[model samples]
Target: TQGKEKVDDAEEVKFEIWKKNSDKNSSMLEAKHDQHGIYTAKTVIKEPGTYTVQVHVTARKMHVMPKTDLSVN
Candidate 1:
């Protein structure tokens, strides 16, 4: 979802969520691939704060990391 291109069949995707101030407060979830190369991950945020969501993609012997900020009310 972070990249413009579609994911390849051999690629592996992971979704990571973490608190902005703490590396220990992090969660990693494996993404499920759907039709049309869409990858999805669901997580429940119990705390209301600023967090970072990163997409870790591995494909073609390379790794790509894309991250975004998320604020949960």
Candidate 2:
């Protein structure tokens, strides 16, 4: 994920994924709907560390952002 603003379209699900490791930085990403109720995206994480992942979802004038942590081995 990187610092890129996603222009949200109407009536569509907009996903902006933000990732930052132990090092303070900026990034973001998105994925398509492959299965029912499931969204998938690919990201290249080479460094092994703790990453703060903030998920931003916007759809039909509804916006929700949740933050979590990811540890890579």
Per-residue lDDT for 1-73 in model 2, tens only? 1125343342333344334533446466665655544555677787776777666666556666767877888
Q: 1-73, model 1: which lDDT tens digit per residue?
A: 3367765463789998998888657799999887777788998999899999998888767788889999999
Candidate 2's displacement at residue 34, Å, is 1.6
Clashing pairs in 1: none
TM-score of 2: 0.63
What's model 2's lDDT at 34?
Answer: 58
lDDT of each candidate versus the true structure: 0.83, 0.56
What TM-score would you give candidate 1 relative to the actual structure? Answer: 0.81
Give the lowest summed-lDDT range of ten residues in model 2: 1-10
Model 2, residue 55: displacement in angstroms?
A: 1.0
Q: Tell me, what's the RMSD of every candidate?
A: 2.5, 8.3
* Counted clashes in each candidate structure: 0, 4
